[model samples]
Target: MEWKTTSALSNQAIRTVGRIVEGSHDITIFSNTRAHPLSAQVAGIDIGRRTLTLRVFCPAGNIGDYLSDGLVSFDLEKINRDDPPLLLCFEKVQATCERIHSSLFEVRCTLADTLLITIKPGGVRVPFVLGMSASVSLDVYTGLTISARLCNLSVGGCMLEVPLEDSMPLTIHQQLPNIYIQFPNGEGLRSKGSIRNMRPFGRARHVAVGIRFIDLDRDMRQRLLYFITESEAELARRMGMENRRAGISPLFLVSPHDKKPANSNKRRNKLPPMAHAIKEVARQQHIILHCLKNERPFPEDMLYDSADTLLHLAESDRHQFLYALRYLSEEAAWVRHSVRVAALLGDVLPTQPGLVDDAREAVAGILLHAMGKPLLLSEHLPSLDTHLTASQRNLLKHHVEALRRQLHKVGWSPGPVLNRIVGDINERLDGSGYPAGKRAEALSELVRTASIIKIVDTLTHARNGRPALSPLDAYRWVYGNDGYDKKCLTRYVRRYGLYPVGSLVKYTGGFLAWVMELDREGSPRQVRVVKNLAFQDSKLDTVLADQDIQQIGKLEEVVDPANFQL
Candidate 1:
């Protein structure tokens, strides 16, 4: 989003704490500190065959302390200070001198053995256990019954050394009934488990498979804590496992839904004001883009959170308003570019009555637009090859039909504007667009708007690398005769201007400052002169937003290299 400057303020630090205040647009000064620094503390202990050493450090405290001992336990005393204090604890122990049983060490598996496993239906890989801890539920598909032991497990999928009968096909609806595993203490984590996987082991006598809890409710998850804790303790006892010692890698577990409360002890973390919410929406949009690339379905709760945040931001901060639009576009690849294109195509609406609703529907459409990609290798998205056969294009066109079918199953019914936005984000008014070559009159204004945003988003990524197109350059590109709808484009350009406020720019007069707010004449005012004449000076050192653009008209005409000189 763009900001305008009127120059009444100086050297102001804008800290966006979105989760602190909901709906209200308010900024309060907490301290006059030039820069606010947050701190993190970390501690580590290393255990070798014969000894152990411990150390702790605090960035905020500027303290480095160490203590060492043999098989001794201690507690960390909480330190209170003016600045927020963080605690990080870590430990490492060597394996050479550990008193581990050779039998336990030789938990072996042979070739031709099929291991039983279970997981969420249609999930790709099992969770990787070697990294951070994760919970998985294992269930029986037909009976719809769940195992208490396998219900929610913290272990990486166990290895089974038993051979499976030909009766098990390892298909989507099939299960392998028997698998066994022995923990370090000779206790069985899972014995005679069924169907997570049953593929024959390559050359070894064991088939390594994955299992997830099928009915792991909150209570069940809580119960699994004891198992996890005990497993960690047992592993550590035998292998001298300590912090930094990697766990067994498990297969990736796909959760049934997404969006949990923010993982923290603190509850009631109030939502941030409109401006802050807008930034977060943008951040989540990027995260969505990442999730889609990996074929991971968007989490339901995250979608709602972002949607709510956008609705609030659209009330004010129109310049940043398109961020919500961008969020939707990322969901549907065809419409993925539509929101930015729409925002670039028209002015911020005087009213945003159903903008959020429109955005939500559009996201669903965009997400399904490329569903056929995975069905056909050539069209599988993120496809970058220059050459393609006619068959591949035909295969790609089936995505919309596939999209409709899938959405119907999920009870999604998009309105007309949304339908067009998703359908024609790839279309052109000149009848040169793809998917459908419909012209301007045939498309809804909302759809047209989405298209323009899509184009801008494409251009943003294409032309801009470390440095993006200047506001003027962006406008020039979009407003040209061959560009998007001119009337719509002009309205958008005027409001956002060549360079919106808050952005750092270098003027023709060679002054460096942040654009503060716009004036009646649509000119930028300086917020702070980070440097003047390419060098820092006493006058350019502090924040200055109290000055008006009329006082610095010449400097207002300049545009710095987008991201550079900022």
Candidate 2:
């Protein structure tokens, strides 16, 4: 859904977190004396006082240090997958200690006016602020050396702000053998690029020259993506904050059946606020992935703690948690895969409740099961196709080994149950899986869950590919005396029915709805209509046309999502 937000002070609806109060966010704290950045949280926000509380945290899930020093600088960004996050950099003008509690402190800092930046998804370039500078040097033209500010940065290219006073003058289509850009946070990018476009900026006697990167390596692309996600997410947070303060409706609102309709003017009890919830999850996932990508040790403390938080959630609030997982799947494709795999496992886990005590742990383990992929690929994203090339296959082959080494390197261990879930995720009972083709006899009972995941993974991959299979056909083929154990297959069908969540379906009435959940009798309990003959948001339309639409049994077939515009 498109979110429209504005600050109360401005007549213009500026979608920014300008002077937000009581908003929660994680931040990176860098000190002149400390070598590495410290992780922190915004404990309290007071817009009237022009200050925010920053509570420093240790990696071991405890607050070890607290400070109100003005010398510290913070580098923070919102990490959004679909939209670029807003990035902010600020220093403490003045700080005061308000109060202290166990592992929590209320320190306040006066902030400068927040600076908003738009970071492109996938490192693509949109317009950006021109405050950042970079060092430029030509490969062949050794005599050329110039420092220029940045106008914008995309994965493929970036525009440099050249001041008119600089002596360096180059013609159009100039080849820059090496361009090194160092962010204020010390994140740097070095790439070869060619001049694509150039123009003049007003009043500053500055010229904007655009350069397109020739071919970015895997690591560079991931870095750019992370940077962009961070920037966009921050802006989204600010927008949300401003709207709330102004007493406006939510910006990132979803239209669930229980909630009031978008078209209705009726008052309704507010659904649990979910925009920040998903962003928090995304931020946690991003942090862990960054650690893994940088060859840093696994952040077991953070990962385990995040999982525990989810595990301990009350049964009533589990719906919100599950909804957040669905939103995360839609936000980022990499995350989408993990959430789907995790959801599928979580759905069937309760069928045999004795197997696992906390289903959330299994869900968390499955969600992060693909961490090995990044450890093996080292920032290169894997394709969602079956026909991977030779090198890709080799990378998948040793992913298990890489995951083990990575965990050990991080100086932490996942406990026995979760370790089993994530450790042997790729290993199959029939010995067709990767990292170790151990037979079913030698595998643990937990290996059967891995087998269920294999089918989920296979069906989703093929359904999302060029040549697709209907969900029913895919289900029948994968479970029909296949590699999956008969017991697991029976449990899966009994719980989730023929169509799974994320499955696209066709109806005789010419409507398409995603299968959401199932009943005790294995019929579709809920579905959010995606398309219809009218082509508007179909949720309300479906409500009018069919109740428990799956029970009407007009399901012509389960179809590939690619065939229709969803």
Candidate 3:
């Protein structure tokens, strides 16, 4: 529907508004252009147009970041008692602004395009910016009340531009252990709340804090309503009275570091088309991993598209695509594993120069080679070592087939050779490997590429959930394994050293570093020091400058972090 010209609010919109006023619920804004959600509260409702004016929040983006963005395209979300659910998504949202206080801006939102409606009740939202006179007490129940002035207020919550006078330990999501809000009329309201967001109000000046009120009792609600409605006129006058002060509305509270003109264009983040498509695939891949880890039902279409994205990426720009995958959700253990295996293959392929041109397809196959294992429950998995359980052995044999099904579900085939490689990682020369235990002559030469992945997989997941083995121990375990190709393993060790890239190692001074590369002698020529046993608690996650490396001589043992005492 054309939200701008629509004369009346839809019944669903009207109900959402009523709920906002009844208890002052909160709303969340999902802006396409912004990385963070704009938490807001409802300021007023239009019963006639089914439209609501929102007071955008400034809790994180520094009051400067919020105002300069001047409203982004976003879908507004809230929850109500309905069968399907309520969601009001807009193609674009426009805004007009006015200064409500020295640190707060009062803005109203309008739809830039027709609204898109969907039935999916998930989260609630409301917009509120404050220009009011109130004494705020936080954590009141604990006898520690923070004296703060209100900058913006909504029925569901309020934004306080707190001065840096008292450096109380404030953190996001920290509960207002207790609150007592004192109004101008000697009326008061006490409520429970938690920090929704916080941002710098200005450089070395004050901070903006967003507090979402919880469990508003009838008495507290009435007092809040009375103060909001009764003082509306004075608030408007205050906003309108001073021309010079009002002139600063567009000044946008800026940071000390970023001093730019108001009209300066926004920083661009739109990726190139090819990069954009790869990004989408990487994003979906991360989500798919999350679903698999949590055992949620994986969407067939999303999975299929993600596969297509990975395959499309293989044609060119493969390095860029791999880099994007490396940065996915820092905690993505599986993504890290995939990159390690890909890098291992990258190191080995040089030994076999003939495979260099086909490296892209090789990398693609290696990435998805082990994709089938994660799809099974732990109870159904077989032990890879000596005491193999029946289920474990069975899983090992058909794991390639399982991967094949996943590829089919995405309507993707990893090319003929790549398809075989994905399933053939388990097949060995001596016919000991399961599923299709083709003898050496029967196995295609492509098995050499998958061998590198197999070797690295053991190192990456040495002890499973336990601390991984040292680089030396990991190499020893897989070096003479019958299934692996000896030449590939030898080349890998020579290039990456016993400790390969991404391996954590200890040094002569009890410090820990991740080995980045090796010199001619295979000593760690470069390392990123992550733990300093000497200082114990100095700086961490740092790289030793090349000039400083000469000062530290010799190397220590390769130790598992779980056994290391810091």
Whole-model lDDT values for every prediction:
0.37, 0.51, 0.51
Off by over 4 Å in 1: 1-276, 279-308, 317-347, 351-411, 461-467, 501-504, 508-516, 526-542, 546-566
Taking all chains together, each candidate's TM-score versus the true structure is 0.43, 0.59, 0.48
Candidate 1 lDDT over 81-137, as tens digits, reads 221111111111111112123311110101110001122332111111212233222
Which segments of candidate 3 are over 4 A away from where they belong?
A: 1-284, 287-330, 377-397, 465-467, 545-547, 561-566
Question: For model 2, how does the per-residue alpha-carbon lDDT over 60-121 read when each residue is reduced to its tens digit?
Answer: 32222223333345545443333222234343335555435543455456543333222333
Q: Candidate 3 — worst ten consecutive residues by lDDT sum?
A: 260-269
- Top candidate, metric TM-score: 2
Query: 1 or 3, which is superior by TM-score?
Result: 3
Model 2 ranges with Cα > 4 A deviation = 1-71, 75-85, 91-98, 110-283, 309-332, 351-353, 358-361, 378-387, 463-468, 480-482, 533-553
Q: What shift in Å separates residue 315 of candidate 2 from its native position after superposition?
A: 4.2
Question: After TM-score superposition, what is the CA distance of residue 433 in candidate 3 from its true location, in Å?
Answer: 1.5
Q: After superposition, how far is residue 306 of candidate 2 from its true place, in Å?
A: 4.3
Candidate 3 lDDT by residue in tens digits, 340-403: 5654455455457677656556666665664565544233341222245655756656756766
lDDT value, residue 126 of candidate 1: 18
Write the candidate numbers in order of decreasing TM-score.
2, 3, 1
